[model samples]
Target: MSGSSSTAANLVRTVKVKAEKKVYSLPGQKYAVPEEREPLRIFYESLSKQKPESEMAEFWLMEHGMMSPERAKKAYEKKQKRQKHQRMGTPIKAEISKETSESSRKSSNAKNDQRTKKRSLEYEDSDDDDLIMKPSKAKQK
Candidate 1:
């Protein structure tokens, strides 16, 4: 029983040492890219050439040490702006004056009020005309 307990104690100590070592080593660990691999280099180079404007190309350049992280980040932001502009189509050059904007808002509010009044009148007329009769409980009995 004593021998078993001693072995268990040794196992626990080894596990704790391993856990501490892992925690300490994680922050300082740097990832080493396999630069010696010709196929991977060629693949990334081809991808970068094919889609120069794409995020994947930027990532490939950054990962392969061809572009710095800061440059990649700027390129990514520019790409995003370009795509957003493309999606939004042409920008309107005409600016509305404050007076015109306020007038338009007032006119729109008036139109909405008129529309609601018309809708309520139509609903009232409809309710009076379409009377759905329900059978009385006395008739059922």
Candidate 2:
């Protein structure tokens, strides 16, 4: 019953306020509410074109030897310093493994053979310009 009475009182107050506004002139002009700015189309477009930040960070790590940028820079600086020292001592020659040495020798021999064949062709040409002008063999009827 109390809730119903309170609701009735609220309704009467609302009606009174509406009637008062209709009878009396309200003070100040009602300004138009400003329109909201449109969503940023260009920002979305730019974001779509870009690689993901995490992927870019991973690429950056791989580029700098898979280390943190700071650590990579420190390592690079240390290497540069060591190189600048120009320490001279008995040079450590690289040891060629037997398998690698044999493969390399085979490749070298193949290259030499190619060169020899090329030279032989050149020599034949030098010996006679007509060497390459041999008549085609044909069975005479």
Candidate 3:
């Protein structure tokens, strides 16, 4: 009996939307802000170099109270990747092959199959290159 679409349309809208920036403050107003990625990355690399095969990077973030355990674990993965780049002395980039396109792959596969068929055809009891040979099938007698 109340708030019909027609009646609602007739009345002026009073819905208020909040556009203010939201802030997250801990119980003691402690803000969990992470340090710059570069410095953290450098520190992580140094720490990793000092003690290889240890999960110190995640604990480092936890010790600093910069992020939660879950988030720290994710950041640790990033730390490991960066450390790998540093240890390698060169950043390995993925190489993109031009002939890997969908149409090219299909056309290349078809061409290879056709060439194999033509080669098989030449061995079918004739040295003549002009004759098209059909592949013989085994028929059960």
Model 3 stretches astray by more than 4 angstroms: 1-63, 92-141
lDDT of 2 at 127: 54
RMSD of each: 14.0, 28.6, 16.5
In terms of lDDT, which candidate is stronger, 2 or 3? 3
Which ten contiguous residues of candidate 1 have the minimum total lDDT? 21-30
TM-score winner between candidates 1 and 2: 1
Instruction: Quote the positional error of residue 111 for candidate 2 in Å.
Output: 0.8
Residue pairs with clashing backbones, model 3: none
Sorted by TM-score (best first), the order is 1, 2, 3
lDDT of each residue in 22-48, candidate 1, tens digit only: 321222222334475568767777787
Clashes of each: 0, 0, 0
Where does model 2 exceed 4 Å of error? 1-86, 127-141
Q: In candidate 2, how many Å is residue 3 off?
A: 99
**Model 2, span 11-35: residue lDDT tens:** 8643334433332121221222222
Q: On residues 1-141, what C-alpha lDDT tens digit does candidate 3 reach at each position? A: 667977977897789998875454321112354556768756865776687444565456444545555665565566667679989897855444776677788999999999999988888858576775888999999
